[model samples]
Target: MLPREKYIQISLEINLFYQRIMKEHMLLIETHLPSVETALITEADSLKISMEQILSETVILANGNISEESIESHSIVTPFTLPCEEITSKLTGATINTNITMAELKLEAGTPSCTPWLEMEIDDINRRTLNLLDVIISYKKKLMEWVLNCKVFLMIYPEMLEHLIREARLYKRILNCLLDRKLPEFTLCEELDFWNNIMGEHAEFIDGMLDPTEKDLKEKARGFIARFERLVEECIKTAEKLIIQESLVATEDLRDYEIDATIGLLECKIRSVIPPILADHVLREAYHYILILNHK
Candidate 1:
């Protein structure tokens, strides 16, 4: 691969890591949002307008795409603590209004919150879901910009660079829908298996790169390359399987994502990077040793 391509591959791998973290954040948000929404949907039966208002505000925070300023001005997230059962028992049934300003509440020994509490609910789930879709779509623009101009593509190793670039292409296409809530079970299972296999192969790649060349270490390098190729072949097969099963598996799981289908993805990229870096390390040592010997 050319220098430019190699550099780009590295950048792609880095960006892929970024994408993986974003997925983790999404998973965390989803973990709580659904149940919170379910509870609100059940309890907020009589206050439709109030509930809807709260839902809209929560959805904005839940999506987590807007600026803090935008959210703050709109009070996208409420901050308040409800009275414990002990305190509530003293007051019978007191209703809290949404209009209460958060700053005014005195948070002392007993009071827990400054403003009224808001709950996320299902009536506005569609909005949040659609917002997620938009975020994923927006990611494409970022991916394109990185793919086209990332510094990693500037590396000298053209062959390796090209390989990484091609893989990034596959990765980018798959990224489109990886965040969808309604994921396919079987396909996710298959992708995870494939991702694990790739990780194993990548580990070997790292070992091969870091290893000092013995009397026959070049032979080992060749063997390692063969194994790497086999792993790639397996990955290709897995990719094909996804395509055959569903026309858009890539849209759901990037070649680099660490979802159920793409877990261990970062480790593999790290592994892939190690080999060349190791080789360079050894090469530098060889050049220094040769100079010393010649001087002697």
Candidate 2:
């Protein structure tokens, strides 16, 4: 069984990272929809707001409850996160809570322990997050089906919708594991396979969204896609420490690329429909993967 403190720490840390991410996914969907799609846009906006409220709660709960290693991993908030949110909020005409980012930045890592009441609070938060994810996951699937059937046109890609669903499911799974007071039921190679596929899809999405004139950037994105695809294949074929190491290296490289791309997007030096916050979001995921692989 997982220790109480460890459980609370993991629950808060995961929520802090993923709630913000899921909210941004909603914002992207909301902003990209046509004005005529009022119902869809409102649903997305409502989900986004729900996620924001949960994230705010998480930040308050996690202020002194997170681990130093997790904070140092840069998986929660990178230096570019604030600027990316600021610029993306302006461009998308959506409100992003930069205060959350600021508060996260000020978070002080605490010892590996918590009070019993805090543990109970985290338990409640996890349950609430699980319910929210269910709604958002259903919404994402509905959107994907509509797009696939050609019943609606969205500026967002169908694959992007699918990607959002996968992430929400992953978040739900993690919360369920923590709530159960058990470790995640994933082998190292299985975990690698999941994140590797996510990274590959991110590259594909970036490649598809980039302007045709940006040949060099597109080429780099393709390279990452191919590299991660190969890693995923290796993961399927074998469970080895070497594969984890390779994945770590690849993720580090991709993290750097994402950082550069995010900066370019913020500086208006890159041409793409990708939001700056989206770039930073992918970067944070890569960083999160790196932390896991490094632990292995």
Q: TM-score for every candidate vs. truth?
A: 0.24, 0.97
lDDT of 2 by residue, 60-179 (tens): 889778899889988899999999999988887888879889989888998745688888889888999899999999998889889899887889778788888888988888888888
TM-score of 1: 0.24
- Clash pairs of candidate 2? none
Query: Candidate 1 lDDT, tens digit per residue, 203-283?
Result: 343344433532243344445446434544554455554433331232122212212111222123223223222222222
Q: lDDT for every model?
A: 0.30, 0.88
RMSD of each: 23.6, 1.2
- Runs of candidate 1 exceeding 4 Å displacement: 1-155, 182-218, 228-296
lDDT of 1: 0.30
Query: Judged by TM-score, which candidate is best?
Result: 2
